[model samples]
Target: MNIAVIGLGLIGGSLIRALAARGHRVLGFDADPAVRATARDAAARMPATGRWQVTATIRDVAADADLVVLAVPLPALHNVLDALVASGFHGLITDVTSVKGQVRDAVATRLTGAANPVAGFVGGHPMAGREASGFASGDAALFTGCAWVLCLDEGVGLDDWLTVAELITELGARVVPATTEEHDRAVAAISHVPHLMASALAANAAEDLLALTLAAGSFRDGTRVAATRPELVAAMCGGNAEAVKLALAHVIQRLDGAMQALEERDPVKAVRAWAAEGHATRGAWPPDPGRPEEVPAHVETLLRLGRAGGWVTTVAPDRRTVTGFLPVSNA
Candidate 1:
């Protein structure tokens, strides 16, 4: 497939390398001239994986490309789409953004015109990243074993969704189909809130010499993603503010209860009672993702699999079936 990718940052650059390595022609573009030069120079030393080049302009990236990946930050999505719209790119488009709800709305509004009523836009968010940014940290192996989300909203075209899913599964990541709303809510409870927790933990311990010295695996691991760039974290948390707010309410309530428990007469018993569910949840830290199975690659089945904590490992090339992992409810 001929593919064009915008924003040659870590995930974007990695997408380029991974797809090209799999023999897909790729053309990538970055706003930063230095990053563009770096990618071009780096692509030189790597063995010929597939045919790819760094385009001089965003407009050029869409020319004759089968798929165009918008890997830019959340706030920049509109501008990128506008550029693509102006350039008359009617090919299949997907994104690697953290937030999906906003992207879905934007695609529906901007890309759906009378001339192109059936816009092949499938909102995507690859649940993979690094604390580091730029094209320098990109690795084709970054997405291996990761969960790549492909929005499965009602209006999403089946063929378009399958095409994006196929590309994601080909890159060695499991495709988790979900609605834009479900995807946003799930990610807020999991990814966004966790990042906030990590930030708070790090902030509370900063400049305290003893706390820093005594920090072990628990503290270090808990605060790992706190090392991510601030602007990037802000965009992620801010872009999905409504969902994040809803998720934060539950977290705040639990924390308030825990604090109240600490002040009780029988503090130990109270605290443990307050934390029983949390303990069980933490103990199940990477829950068994269930066994893999092949199923018809229909939207209803994919959504059912996702709601059951399952993911699609492989989609049949003809879009008729998929090999997916259907997770257990209590394993």
Candidate 2:
């Protein structure tokens, strides 16, 4: 495929390497001259047979491209879409933004004219990233064994979705289909809220320099995400503010319960049980080996029940049953 990747940051640069390594011609573009230069240097070192270059302008990158991946920051996505539309790009388009709702809306609004840049647009968020940014941090292996979420809007055709999914799967990531709203809510609970919690924990601990100095494994691991770029964190959390707020509220309620339990005459039992629950939950995270779970025959029914605020139980291939909580109602 003749692919163009906008924003030669970690995700974009990595995609260039991965796609080119898989023998796809890749043209990279970045607004920043330095980033483009960095990408040029990096592309030179790849051993793929496919042609690779760094385009001087977005039009040069988008022209004659079979697919274009927007790996820019969340806030800049819409503008990039506008530029692509203006440049007359009519290829398949997808993005690596964390938030999907805004990006979906932007694509629908901006890429609609007769000469619009996109034949189809799918909102994508690779559940893989580093705290680091830029082309220098690019690694083709970054997305290996990771979950890549794809949000196909109503306008996107099945063939377009398959093409995008095939490219992502070729890069060694499991492709998971999700609605924009579902993707936002899931990421809020799993990624956004945790990032805020890490930031908050780090900030609170900063007040006591001596205590921070003595902080070991737990503190280091817990607060690791706090070191992510503030702008990226702000965009992610702010873009999904409502979902993040709900996740945070649930966390606060849990923490309040833990605090109340700590005040009991014998707090160990209460605290231990709470901690055990989390430990068990974390331990059960399914191992990812580049394949997604099989969809059940009654998947749509299960999803409808979940959206209607019902508790869901999944019976394993064996007789074991796994129960999980669902939102009382869709947000």
Candidate 3:
């Protein structure tokens, strides 16, 4: 596959490494020269060989690519697509934007033409990231075993979906299909709201400078993602406002309950219950469940299988499920 990846940050850089490993001809484009240099070197280290090139111009990168991935931030997705459409580029396009509902709308509205249609666009988000940014922190295995979402819009053919899924799967991710609205709502609960909460918690704690100075591993670990690119997080939160607002309502209720318990001098019990709930939830959840859990369709499958097999799975602290695969029988 001749692949063009824009952005060249952690997500884009990691994609380059993954594709290169499968011997795909990958061309990378980024605004930052240093990132391009690093990606070029990273491509060399892969087991497979491909024509790895870097260019400042999007047209040059998209010129020969059969598949184009706009791995830039959510806000940039539309702009990139617009430019590609203007450049008369011909290829199937997808993006790794966190918020899909808005992105899908943007593409549908902005990139309208006989040349550019919604059918050529597949909205995507990889539910895997690092607290760090930039190409330097990109690891070859960053997306390995992670959930890569494929949001199919109307007119996107079965063959296009399969092509996109194959590209992502070859990069070591499991593919799951999602509607734009469904993806936003679910991720708002699991990913977006958590980042907002982490930042809020860490910020509030910082007011107590002396106390925060003694912050332990727990605090640091809890707030690790609070250090992610603020602009990107903002885009995610803002893009999916309705879903995030609903998710935050649940968050607020939980926080108020916890606070009320603390005010009643039962802080220890409150804390214990919170921690235990996480433990119990994770324990009840299935173990080693695959990426389809990211989608609601497979969620019921998991629940049905769980109820039938005494498995309980959760998405809260990270995906986990506990269940028994039906025993093999000799025929």
Best by TM-score: 1
Predicted structure 1: lDDT: 0.87
How does model 3 fare in lDDT? 0.72
Local error of candidate 2 at 102, Å?
Answer: 1.2
- Please write out the lDDT profile of model 1 over residues 1-331, one tens digit for every residue: 8999999998999999998899998999988899999999988887887546998888899887989999999878888888888888878889988999888888888888785443588888888877777788999999998988899898888898998888889889988999999999999999999999999999999889999999999999999999887887798889899999999999999999999999999999999899899877767766676777888988899899888788998887677999989755442
* Cα-based TM-score, every candidate: 0.93, 0.85, 0.79
**TM-score (C-alpha) between model 1 and the true structure:** 0.93
Worst 10 residues of 1 by lDDT: 112-121
lDDT of 2 by residue, 24-85 (tens): 87899999998888777776775658447999999999997999999999888877877887
Q: What is the lDDT ranking, best to worst?
A: 1, 2, 3
How many Å off is the CA of 285 in candidate 3?
5.3
Model 2: pairs clashing at backbone N, Cα or C within 3 Å? 89-117
Clashes of 3: 9
Give the poorly placed runs of model 2, Cα more than 4 Å off. Answer: 48-51, 113-117, 288-331
* Model 3 TM: 0.79
Query: What C-alpha lDDT, on a 0 to 100 scale, does residue 203 get in candidate 3?
Result: 92
